[model samples]
Target: MLQRSFYERPVIQVARELIGCYLVREIDGETLVGKIVETEAYAGPLDRAAHSYSNRPTERTKAMFQEAGHAYIYEMHTHALLNVVTGRVGQPHGVLIRAVEPIAGLEVMKQNRATVKRQIDWTNGPGKLTKAFHITKALYAHPLNERPLYIEEGEKGVKIARSPRVGIANSGRAADYPWRFFERGNPYVSTFRK
Candidate 1:
């Protein structure tokens, strides 16, 4: 598990470095693991696309204001999107976990995502990855180093690629910011790869 200091860095740095980290989920005694392949930085307060923009701390985004290394799950339509709260306590920065490559508990992940005709589709999107890992609102504000969900160190020499974040065309000039990062040629990366 990574220390709190690891997540207390700048949002963009955390997002980029998270590219090759391992996201682990333990549910019902089964351990599900995946290599994080895609991430997007949300520079809170000033980022129009971030839920914590304007320093607003509503019930849904209150976790964003918590200390770094906490889970900040939010709903998109009916699906839950998982984010890692980064930066200091009063800073609402975060890193959205967009996609992951399944590494362990493949059978359980397939069972969770029943329509997964191909392995890549199991975690190719934020919502899909959350579903496959059983992440939900219940995990909001949970510490990333604690039980059910946590992150572990992964390979050290991975090459990361950067691009504009996905689905935020209305964020003005922030929409063009190259805050999205992913493993260079990983097939399990999201379909929006650039």
Candidate 2:
């Protein structure tokens, strides 16, 4: 399990460093694991693309104001996206886990995403990844170091690439910020790879 301090740093740093980390989900004795392949950083109120932009705190975004390392799950359209809260209290910074490569419990993931015909498609995007791992809004504000969901250290020395975040075309100048980070040449990265 990663220590709380691991997520206490700046959101951008945490987002970039999360590449290659293992996202583990232990449910009903089945331990599902995946290697984080892509992430996007959302800085505090200053970042227009962030849900907490302008210091706005709605009931849905309440988890973002919690201590670092907490889950900040939120709904987008019909899907739930997972974010790791970062920065200090009242500073609503987070790192969105964009994609992951299956590392364990492949059969379970396949079962969870049975509609996905291709193996790579199972966790190639944020919503799809969360579905495969059974992550939901119920996990909001849950600590990342706890059971059912946690991040563990994975392979080191991974080369990373950065680019503007995906699906934020209306964020004005913030839309072009290079906050997205992904493992170089990782096929499991989202389709928006740059």
Candidate 3:
């Protein structure tokens, strides 16, 4: 599993390097794993697109300000979005896990995302990947270097693609920042492009 040092780096660097890592979750005696395909970096305070922009803190944004290697989960439109907190404590930096490619326990993922139009849709977006992986607010603020949920080492030589982050079009120049990273030509990446 990835250790604390893996996440205690600049949020932008952490986000870019996450493209080919493994996200692992174990629940109810079942294990599900996916290869991280896409991510969007939200640098703290200075990043207007960040939840903790300007150092603003709230009940929901608390996780983002915690030390690195924690899950910064939240709800939006009734769907859970998962983020990996990065940098040191009080930084509020994080990387939103935008997509993943199913690596194991696909049956469980299919059950979780049964209505998805295709197998590729099972984890082709932030909310979709959370549902497919059974991720929820219950994991919010939880450490990510341990059991139940953790990141594992994965392929190291993946070619990366970059683009503006999805949504938050009103965040001024922040909306145009090329902060999104993904595996080049990965079929599991989100269909939306900036």
Per-residue lDDT of model 2, residues 87-131, tens digit only: 898899999999999999999999999988999999999999999
lDDT of each: 0.93, 0.94, 0.92
lDDT score at residue 18, model 3, on the 0-100 scale: 90
Q: Which stretches of candidate 3 lie over 4 Å from their true place?
A: none
> Over all chains combined, what TM-score does candidate 2 have?
0.98
lDDT minimum window of 10 residues, candidate 2: 185-194
Q: Estimate the TM-score of every prediction.
A: 0.97, 0.98, 0.97
Clashes per candidate, residues 3 or more apart or on different chains:
0, 0, 0
Cα lDDT of candidate 3 equals 0.92
C-alpha lDDT of residue 59 in model 1: 85
> For residues 95-118, what per-residue lDDT tens digits would candidate 3 score against the true structure?
999999999999999999988869
Candidate 2, position 189, lDDT = 95
Q: After superposition, how far is residue 130 of candidate 1 from its true place, in Å?
A: 0.5
